[model samples]
Target: MAYTLGIDIGTYETKGILVDHAGAVVAQAARGHQMLVPRPGWAEHRPEEDWWGDFVFVCQTLLRESGVDPRAIKAVGCSAIGPCMLPVDVMGAPLMNGVLYGVDGRAEAEVRDLTDRIGEDVLIARCGNALTSQSVGPKILWLKRQRPELYAQTAHVLTSTSFLVQRLTGEVVIDHYTAANFAPLYDVQTQGWVDDLAEDILPLERLPRLMWSNEIAGEITGRAAAATGLAPGTPVTAGTIDAAAEALSVGVDRPGDMMMMYGSTIFIILRAAERVADRRIWYAPWLFEGEHGSMAGLATSGTLTRWFRDQLARDLDPAEAFRQLATEAAASPPGANGLLLLPYFSGERTPLHDVHAKGAFFGLNLTQTRGDMYRALIEGIAYGTRHVMETFADLGQRPARLRAVGGGTNNRLWLQATSDITGIDQEVCDKTTGASYGDAFLAALAIGAVRRADIAAWNPAAETVAATPDPVYEKGYALFRRLYQQTRDIAVELP
Candidate 1:
């Protein structure tokens, strides 16, 4: 009657699950949080409020609602939307709000400074990534150069999951997957920190110890036990970046398996044998050993849909609004009747590393309705995926198949559009996201309840929907490919 818990903190919400050896989410809970936007192109989250507070709720709620024995919980694994930079004091108190993932663009200047200081080739060769807002190093440089007082007082810099682990186990350590984004700061080739990358960056002592994501870092302390309502000594592993963990949750265990997560920001991760270093695509070691992967990113996927809903659907409930939009969008023919959109509302990433890239609509005839615009947005995101998918293929790293997960797949029409545009057969995982399932699965593996040697024995949720591309989509996707360059001029013309 033992159990495991997988808790995940996302950009806008937190979700957790309590499950036994068989992988059924016996009890689940979630809490929503507001993303703070103080200025244009900046996103922040109160680490105490959004990151750990929601976790407190999920932990307590799942424990109570499941009626599971607190002591019987073999382990707790956590995952978070990350590469978040929040410098903390010695007591694990946040010095300021966390830089909210890649969505926040406050560190553009720092990015340039890093690329100039370290040079792109050294960064790419060493950390397997180049400077983008996604890198933790630039954020650190921002704090150091901009807010010297905070940087000087800073006791440690941590990502989201490691922050939680510090609060839980009274330990400060980051996983390699999360630390990989600390490019130019972490010497991945040497498997250690590179203290000499930048003279103006945060002090080297601030970085946390790095470990593989699955290695048990420490046991939850008594203080964390009281807050989370769990046995104090329960083992907690060094978790991973939310996307990598989500990739794991969707059965991207072995090499060549790809997980395309359709969530707030669409993330594509594919496993490979050796590091296929590409500046266009991020490369990182997978959670467990003998696995490495490359990542493709889209800044706004579900964010675009959410934006449309907030601005256009003031009269509709969330469910009804998405349902109506999906229905109408589905009714529109492929390519939304010759419409194309570049979904770079927050700026494009992956395949094109432009931070100033803007978004626009092409072939938007006056005859097109709001519904057509909505479907055009959907198609734009699908085209974005195809752009990166083609890059992977060009590198001879194309995945054999794709497993789709997260909230975007909840809308069958969106998933269908994505599958059609990419021409990849999509398998929709049941409603589970992030590292939660992978947390449970990893816990299962740890205790020998489920053997990792045979993945078939560790079954994930049954596929609820399957999408296959139609041949008619071929010419449409080909046309969609040209829209990025064709519309780039129009997008910049707006402002």
Candidate 2:
């Protein structure tokens, strides 16, 4: 009765699953945590408490609940929100809270500085990405300039998954898919750490060893075994980011097979036939050796809904609030009765990459209700997603099939609105367990229990969200595009 253990630390929750050799989920466990926002445009997580602690709890819970022998668990796979910026000492102890991905805009100044210093063309040619808040290189520079004392004491700069992998196996390694986001620090052509560019920001030695996602990083140490209640010497794979694992979970492996992840933010990954170098979107090496990956993300998606639920629907019970909002939103008509929203609460990513962008509700009137506002908010995010998809189309990289995953996929309004706005059908798998399930499959791959092509058989797509074209959405999407351009100057001036 051999099995694999998979765990993923997401923005607001950590989930773990145990799967038998046949890909049947034996048991699952999850833990919720808070995303600390110290100030505007900054997001951080206490790695020790939120990441490692959750890993330990989930592992022990899964083993206890399933009553599966710890020795039966073969390989372990992990994924997390990334490419986060976390400075750790030589012992891999956290020196500071982990800075989140594109949503954290503290590196705005550093992004501009590096783009000017390194030349956008050179960066794009070498790393296949431009300097933006999402680029970990800029975040590293921001740390050096803003916290020189801490930077001086730093021994390693680790992302969330790398941190967990090291904790599990005492090996500091990162996957190529995740490392590609470390723009200006990672060389796409060379597929390795760029010493010449990274040395200027931080020593190259501080970077983790690079490997493909399926490769075994190291065996779990005795110390980790004791903490996790798993047997010592269990193999752990070089895992990837949550979105990549989520994509894999839904069998997004072939060229033009895309996965749209509706989580804290909306993340899109498309399997490309070849490496793409574009300023509007990022492309990188895929999980396996030969394939290529193209990606884009919105800064805020699910988070906007959370904010509304907390602030506007505070009187309602937390559990009931979302349902109430959804009920009202579903009842509202397509255009939300002339209300429009820009879901730039955490600024914009992907095509715009505008850190100064601000969220707004346009056409709000006395007639508008909470349900109307909520529908408009979801519709705005859908429009933003369509903007990214159009960029892919411009590059001749439109997705042939779209797989939907993550917590937001469970929201009918959001998913249907996205379909309507983008005019692309979305396929949904029977198991929307998200990234942890993908991690389990990756673990199975590392142990030779599953083939690269076995994912479809393991988790087949069973449903689809077909595009429902609406005249209102057609006109609103056009207005959505114009609103951003007309309001850009004003958004930049916001204090």
- In order, the Cα lDDT scores of the candidates are 0.81, 0.93
**Ten contiguous residues minimizing lDDT sum, candidate 2:** 194-203
**Model 1 lDDT per residue over 1-495, tens place:** 888888888777888988888776688888998778797667788999898999999999998898888998998888888889999888889999988777777788989977987789988888888888788888888888888898877999998898998999998898887888887787767767787777557667788888877677799899999998989999888887788877877778777889888888899999887888878898877776556789988888988888899998778888589988887787788768777777888877788876667777778788897788898899788888888999999999978767887877778778877777776777655544556777776656655567664333444546634456676567657776676666666655564
Expressed as tens digits, the lDDT of each residue in 22-114 for candidate 2 is 889999999999889999899999999999999999999999999999999999999999989999998899999999999999999888888
TM-score attained by model 2 = 0.99
TM-score of candidate 1 against the unseen true structure: 0.94
* Residue 81 miss distance in model 1 (angstroms): 0.4
* Runs in model 2 lying further than 4 Å from the true structure: none
RMSD in angstroms, candidate 1? 2.1
Report the lDDT of model 2 for residue 420: 90
C-alpha RMSD for every candidate: 2.1, 0.9
